[model samples]
Target: MSGNSVPGQGAAPRRSPEALPPRSKLAITASRVTAAISRRAGKGSGSVIGGKLALRLAPDLLAQLSVGLQVVLISGTNGKTTTTRLVAEAMRAAGPVVSNALGANMPAGITSALAGAGDEARYGVIEVDEKYLAGVARDSDPVAIALLNLSRDQLDRAAETRMLAEKWREGLRGRDAIVVANADDPLIVWAASSSKDVLWVAAGQTWQEDSWSCPQCGGVMQRPGDDWFCSQCDFRRPSPTWSLAGDQMVDPDGRIWPLHLQLPGRANRANAVTAAAIASLFGVPVEAALERMKHVTAVAGRYDVVDYMGRKLRLLLAKNPAGWVETFSLINPPPTPVILSVNALDADGKDTSWIWDVDFTQLAGRPLFVLGQRRLDLAVRLEVAGLQFQVFETAAQAVAACPPGQIEVIANYTAFQQLRKTIKEAAQA
Candidate 1:
């Protein structure tokens, strides 16, 4: 047995549980139960533990941490989970890494992910939800933080881009960790500047929608028609430390570039750029990282492609405006048969307002199969937008009605899950 602890050097004794403050068993039990539910429901969709329920249960569970661990927290209106996975994969090349393979970006979901990774991991990479960014910063002193682009998403659950930017700025205030941001986004550039160690990456531009007004001034931001620049204020797209250059900017199938992303849509360039920038920061060589990115199969429902019955179908998760615009723009030359799944309820925030923001007019004259619980809502929006489509009340009926040609299924969070499961079940039968 060790003797009494010395003043400065000799030895110290471990304390028993009575010597330490007691924890609430009720809180621990709740966290455990929540975690089990999350696992069973599958990480594909985080609707198992209600969002409000998860938020309420996370704080107490976070209070039990005695270990000083380094965490990498990433949050944005879009691309958070994909970028988180990319960084985790790259970091894994350097050392042991643990991350939530599923797109669980909320606070309690994050707590659930961290708790499940076990205590042995040397590093942790987590994708935080936009609304919960501040809460995460307050709870965990992350080793690094990545602030991706701010885009208009669910205005019901989340605030406007400016409001979310202000929240992120506040969350990133006192961190000593390195913060990587998209230099191209005016909002991200402004917020990322608040940090000392900032790395900026750009993916150029493709399309624009709500990024019209200047955050600093009340004037309309100026764009050179092709590229976006703010003439109202000094806030402009910064010169990025890393930019997707050369043939890398070309389309995936174009002969100019050898890179082929399984994920469709040009918006994936932004995701790829974010992934590449993250990989470079973690010591993965640019060339080698690009090589690995070239072979990326898919990140689940985010433009994930699947093969069924000798037919190729792509599953695109277009939950927000930016996503919708990007995906719509990628539908050029159009596939023969296209399927869209939409849902509006508690699980998906019951916000059908986002449909108004999508450029469904691009699908004008082209036929699409729109299906889900909120098929009427989607049909109404499409009709208002003057886009033609067939509506189905259920996903199964819509999928069955799918034309025998190549199909592209575009869906949101829950809709994506329902579509995937339907396709899987149909294949098994």
Candidate 2:
């Protein structure tokens, strides 16, 4: 373990019950009240709205809520929510933890999550949006920061991959937090290279389209047997202390620990490895951490199997091209049916052009059903890929029309939430 690692045992130093100013206390009270009302009204969790109102009333409530707690901020384009859940579960082996388990990654949502935490909560596991990472880090003063893989997502609203990488680099330059970063990705490596203390993990990266060039020298990158280097400059992949080999995790001493996770796909195995690495920083044993992570079968609604319309539907969320590529690997084989849902709402990126980047030809032999506001856009892309698909108006319609058996449903942000709600409502009825 690093010298900077925190001890897991013993009581965390308690903060005064009256530490917050009167106004900040009032803000937290208002936030919790509004969230409860929202849930009762069937609006939603209301984390965003409640936190927005709290911040409006008390702008520094986030910092006030973070005092005396060890915070870990996780940011990435893909797998942030899953990784956050895994880490939070593992950290419980050390002490009580609070997390945004509902997939809200922005400031308002984060505030609501923290405002409701009890005094026994000693650690904060926050999943932050990639763009808001620097500010969150500044306010929370985290003890550790996990920088997962970065890829192209929401191009209509987000900056380019290289630009975001630069922002991360500048944001993390002189920070004292321990940075756990992925060494397989050149962009992630560059972003965390400036940190004083870094724990690099060779977590596999399946999608390499966005990281073909070195972010520093603008040169072609060479990958030689699990290693990457820049041909034009002195930049290369760092030597990682931890790595993932198949379903097993390799520690610094080369000891192998098999991860028997309930989550599906290689992406989740990589997430487990990352979560184990983060838990180790707080003095949790790697074996115990992996054991705790095995209990997380589903995160939010991802990988949830629910019966709707007499068909077993497994829900998978894929918001971008890289995510879609990973999602395709976890579905049933060709003959089984699959449904693809997409939306162009602000939550799901208004521009639908990124769908062209995904290789939809792989679903050629399967029965494909398309739906959502952007069904036509997805149908056109599938048509261009020489695949046949049927368009449906609703998730129930698509599931009812499929052959009565196991089915896979892959959707973007808003579409996935809508499907989960639809299934829940039907089951209640």
Candidate 3:
């Protein structure tokens, strides 16, 4: 993987400020000023607003910011943030890297992240929203793109699974980026197969509900053992150049590198494999990448362990059924209390009906507590699952009620952010 034949080997050339057009330079200046003002006004990170203004001033600001940088775009239904961080941190071994480390994945936030990078940055690792991949790809001209996995998420606002697959297929049709994609997901495979250059990674998929049907022929899929293929069409899982065998990652040369990641669960191990593959393209060794990734204990707020009310609360984010299934595996065994939080804000999808799709029965035996703006909705779902749970008004109350020890708090997008803010403020106070 470190060979010269690799697409983005060696250090990426730097784009001097003189190379940027006057309009783009002015747009970036305006963006920085707006972001500073927004931060002072306590309007959050201001990446979105700053980027909006930048794009308005210079429509090609993203492309301009990306010039002469080896950009790698990461997108999927889940794990985008963590994988983006891993890839970014690993690539840092090559040179300075600029990334959307806060999980702001849209075009506005992506543009903001790029515009904020210093001239010394040689690599750009941007996590893109699955729906906005097409536009980002068109603008960033990335050397590599990583498609993690596709699953049903925000059904009310997002497209169906196969529809998204088609969009990805069309988006990647003519791109020269080396697509490092998950071979285990049929949707991802169908989408990434459109690319001329692809590096398939056998990252295991925990939730198979969305990929039971063939995306190509609309026929049933045959999953005999670890392999999968369309019963009616030639669409099948590609032989992976990189695969995870237990805790170790096998490279294309069949060399096994053990992944001692601080991030928990098989989902994260899969993410590490994908990150290692992307890092390898830039001449970073798989072993070195794995060593770098092992230090990432938390991403954004997910997996962050905070002390609250004399108890340790571990935060976990699960927005959809597939994500919830993976989150369940990360939770401590029964007798350790759990807090479930859900919200129906615009960012979290206005519909709470998707909660019914998750298998909450796995959490039945655990001491469960529900909170958030939509706690009642979650309560009703838990009741239907025949699970015994208590409803709490806040995370504080939930933690106080649980036995003195570590508590797991699982939440969706807005709910997770709210809890993190509340915990942070309390800690600071």
Candidate 4:
């Protein structure tokens, strides 16, 4: 594995749960108590807050708990949660796999996941945020790192795409883990190519305005179909070991595997391919992975349907321009009516300027019902793009406005969470 010491190796093969030092029992107990309290109080999942308290008490919780397991870390601007869930499910073929499927892609979230995992769990699939990827990778010493596409998201906390790429490059420069990277994304290619071992997957990229410049030199990159290369420097996309064709994934061994994910669109098909590629590196067969992924109905309510106020709302979360482009495609051929929800909260990235970059013109003829704190922002964008939309004060009003049938709601981070919380509360009530 090119001098990279992955999990399956080492003299003693220390995968035993006993290999690591003991954790602080007090810290563990405090977190569980907090979690139970939060659940009883109905203040969201409590996974994040509880984990935060636990890690605050015992700072090295994640590192200590990850000692004896083979870790697979998935990091990106978008698609990390869904991809993590798919990969985690596939890793079950090996043994027990633990993951933060709740979209908590931070250190505290990983700490919480570890705190909840059984002692017999042999593998971990962690969804790491872009800014925290390096630290998480360093502490966990992942056996495989899936570097998905990088783009501008949550600019308040996230580094610029180029700077983030540089950080990722720094993190993987000498690391020995097998990096299954998105070769179609120039930024991901630039970030992960320096690793000791790399297995590229041309899993398709739709948003290109971010990667126009070459990271090596200040020159423009050539876009030939799905391939990219720099004009001024030797920087170029590596040939992929795995490539996507329509909804199918073709392996390097001349085998074609068809994907049947309940999730719609080519973007998700690419995610399925990326997960299968990463799973393949860990000895999980491609067919086995695809078969398992097909059964995944939803990830954190991305494609879930909920009955709200006499309307059936199918939720889709797209937090950034890159994500919006992919999600918009699913709305084509038009459905009953669309509810567009956005917020400017901290989690939603207070700056909503990225919406200008999204191709709202695609919804020109379709009817859109807008809601959330930033409904005015979206209304203005829609107006400028000549798209007709009705603005509503509340999600209930928006759903009521939809034409008495199945409605689709495309929301950003906070709005998505809010809708999910409301539905959960309603269900419990």
Please write out the lDDT profile of model 3 over residues 249-271, one tens digit for every residue. 99999998888999999999999
**C-alpha lDDT of residue 249 in model 3:** 90
> Which of candidates 2 and 3 is the stronger one according to lDDT?
2
TM-score attained by model 1: 0.82
Residue pairs clashing, model 2:
none
For candidate 3, give the lDDT of residue 189. 94
Model 3: which residue pairs collide? none
Q: How close to the true structure is residue 47 of candidate 4, measured as C-alpha lDDT?
A: 80
**Residue 34 CA displacement from its true place in model 4, Å:** 1.5
Candidate with best lDDT: 2
Query: Mind giving the per-residue lDDT tens digits that candidate 1 earns over 130-230?
Result: 88877776776665677877887766676878877877887777667677677667777767777767776666444356567766675577777334567
Question: Order of all candidates by TM-score, from best down to worst?
Answer: 2, 3, 4, 1
> C-alpha displacement of 270 in model 1, angstroms?
2.3
- Among all windows of ten consecutive residues in candidate 3, which has the lowest summed lDDT? 1-10
- Candidate 1 vs 3: which has more lDDT: 3
Candidates' C-alpha lDDT: 0.65, 0.91, 0.90, 0.85
Task: For residues 1-429, write the lDDT of model 2, one tens digit per residue.
Answer: 245475455534645436778998889888889988999999999899999999999998888888878999999999999999999999999889999988788999999999888888899999999999999999988889999999999989999999999999999989989999999999999999988889999998889999999899899999998999999999999999899999899988899999899999999999998999999999889988998999999999899999888788999999999999999999989788999999999988899999999999888789999999999999999999999789999887888778766999999999999999999999999
* Distance from true location, Cα of 15 in model 4, Å: 7.8
